[model samples]
Target chain A: EDQVTQSPEALRLQEGESSSLNCSYTVSGLRGLFWYRQDPGKGPEFLFTLYSAGEEKEKERLKATLTKKESFLHITAPKPEDSATYLCAVSNNAGNMLTFGGGTRLMVKP
Target chain B: DAGITQSPRHKVTETGTPVTLRCHQTENHRYMYWYRQDPGHGLRLIHYSYGVKDTDKGEVSDGYSVSRSKTEDFLLTLESATSSQTSVYFCAIREGQGYGPLHFGNGTRLTVT
Candidate 1:
């Protein structure tokens, strides 16, 4: 069974604080890993996609890194506007359907 | 935004009543998906259509049904609404497999009383 687990269900950080959210997965063959940011009362916005281990992608203050069994979303100098629920998903070799993690809710206090 | 739109952004319905949600996309994508978001369960796929009239059940498709008569339109129907079904529903579309990202609609908020 393919499963995705995100750690630190919720986190609170002051402006400019740096932290990382973890997403671990168990699957037969990893195809791709996706990251999304969802705000309150809105749909999720696409962030990055990692196809292989040791791959990394960054956008502004967010950086996503992937490994053999897990992925990490690191937030650097986060601001209040960056506060949102971060989600991670993985796809197996068989299909395009994504198995999503429960998400990590981050709150940046200014 | 991917030119995706979900009708009746907010809806309140009574339990046992049948309701339908519409997802329309102008991007002409080949894949469409329906998902429900709950407090702690994350987003669970209800159903998805790979092409016109080609739909499949997802992990949480017991109480939901989907129809895709056209490439740009996908509809989700709840045979009998229940309190447990009250949640925000999102629609997404992908151009093709391995494209990496899905364009999502703003989502519809449904409340069953």
Candidate 2:
């Protein structure tokens, strides 16, 4: 079965702290991996999509890197405004439906 | 933010009552999806539509029905609402086929009494 798992269910970081969230997958044929940011009561906002191992994408203070079996979202110099639940999902070559990870709840205290 | 919107952002209904949630998109994307969000579960697919009159069930599709009669609208109907079904519903759309990124709506918070 295809699956995605994220660790550090909840993290509390002070402003300017740098850390990375993990997303490990066991999907056989991965088409893409996605990252999203979701606020408390809103839907997820698209972040980055990594298609292959060694692939990397960035936006502002966030960077995502992918490997054969896992992906990492590294947040640099995070701010309080950057606090949100980060979600990871994978699209398999067999289908368009995305399987999502439970997500990491991040809190960047200023 | 994408041009996706969900109706009845907040709803409270009695158990065993029929309920429907609407998802509207202005981007005219061909792929539309419905999902429910819970505390431990990130997001679970309820149903999805590829085009007008073309829809299919998803992983957690039981007890839910969906219809897409137009390119911009998708509706999820609960035959009879249950307390377990009281969750935040979200609508998403993809701009292209295959592994394209999905844009999501703000979501609908449904409560059953």
Candidate 3:
């Protein structure tokens, strides 16, 4: 079975603080790793999809990097509005279902 | 923003009653998935549909069932509501094949008493 684990169940930071969230996974055949941001009471919003190791993708203040065994979502100088739960998920080459991590709840205090 | 919509934004029901949630997508995506989000457990898939009338079970699919009679609508039904089934249900969609990113609906909050 494919499993995903995210570290630092919860994180708190200042308005301009920069930090990174980790997502570790174990799967039979790595196909793609995904990052999503979910706000309170809303569904998860798509962030990025990393297909291969050493691949990196960025959007505004968020940068997602993937390695063979894990992925990291780096938040650069996050703002108060950036506060949300970040989710990581992975799908194997043989499966269509995504195994999701527990998620990292981030609080950016102003 | 992929035009996914989940109905019954909030629902309150009693145990032993049947409940059905609807997920509609305007983008004509080929794949639709039903997932439940709980406090401790992350998003766990309940069921998924690859095409019309094509359905499959997920990791946590014991008490749930799904149907996809149309190309744009997918439905998840619980045989009997239970307190343990209270969760935020989200529907996700993907257009083509491959391991592409999925776009999710706003979610439906279900509370079983």
Candidate 4:
């Protein structure tokens, strides 16, 4: 079965602290990995899509990197406003549907 | 942000009532998806439409039924609302296949009493 797991269910950090969230997957063939940021009571916002191992994408203070079996979302100097739940999903070569992780809730205290 | 809109942004209904959530897109994207968000569950796919009159179930489609009669509209219906059905529903669209990112609507908050 295809499954996605994210580590550190919740994290609390002070403003300006940097941290990394991990997303691991077990699937037959990896087509793409996606990262999204979702605020409370709102839908997720697209962040990045990594297609292959060693691929990385960055936006603002967030960077997403992918490997053969996992992906990482690194936050640099995060602020209070940057606090949100980060989600990771994977799609197989069949391009059928996305399997999502439980997501990591990040709280940045100012 | 991709011109996607979900109707009945907030709804409260009694159990056993029928409820329908609508998703409309102006981008004319061929791929449209419906998902439900819950605490600690991230987002779970409910149903998706590849094109007009073409739809399929996703990971969590047990109590959900979807219809796509036009290029821009997708509807999700709950035959009988349950307390477990109270959740935030989201709609998404992808322009094409292959590794493109999905654009999501604001979402609909549904509560069952």
Ten contiguous residues minimizing lDDT sum, candidate 2 chain A: A90-99
Clashing pairs in 4: none
lDDT of 4 by residue, B57-103 (tens): 99899988999999999999999999999999999998586657777
For model 2, residues A11-92, the per-residue Cα lDDT tens digits are 9999999999999998969989999999988899999999989999999999999999999999999999999999999988
Predicted complexes: DockQ each: 0.70, 0.78, 0.87, 0.70
lDDT of each: 0.91, 0.92, 0.93, 0.90
- Compare the candidates by lDDT and give the number of the best one: 3
lDDT of 2 by residue, B1-113 (tens): 67998998999999999999999998889999999998898799899999999998888998999999999999999999999999999999986877888889999999999
Question: Model 4, A8-79: lDDT tens per residue?
Answer: 899999999999999999987998889989888777888999999999999999999998989999999999
DockQ of 1: 0.70
At residue A37, candidate 3 shows an lDDT of 94
- Candidate 2 vs candidate 4: the DockQ winner is 2
Q: Write the per-residue lDDT of candidate 1 for residues A6-93, one digit (tens) a residue.
A: 9999999999999999999998799889999999988988899999999999999999999999999999999999999999988788
Q: Write the per-residue lDDT of candidate 1 for residues B1-113, one digit (tens) a residue.
A: 68999988999999999999999999788899998999889988899999999999999999999999999999999999999999999999875655467768999999999
Question: Model 1: runs farther than 4 Å from truth?
Answer: none
The docking quality of candidate 4, as DockQ, is 0.70
Ranking by lDDT: 3, 2, 1, 4
Q: What is the lDDT of residue B94 in candidate 1?
A: 72
Interface root mean square deviation per prediction: 1.3, 1.0, 0.8, 1.5
Top model by DockQ, which number?
3
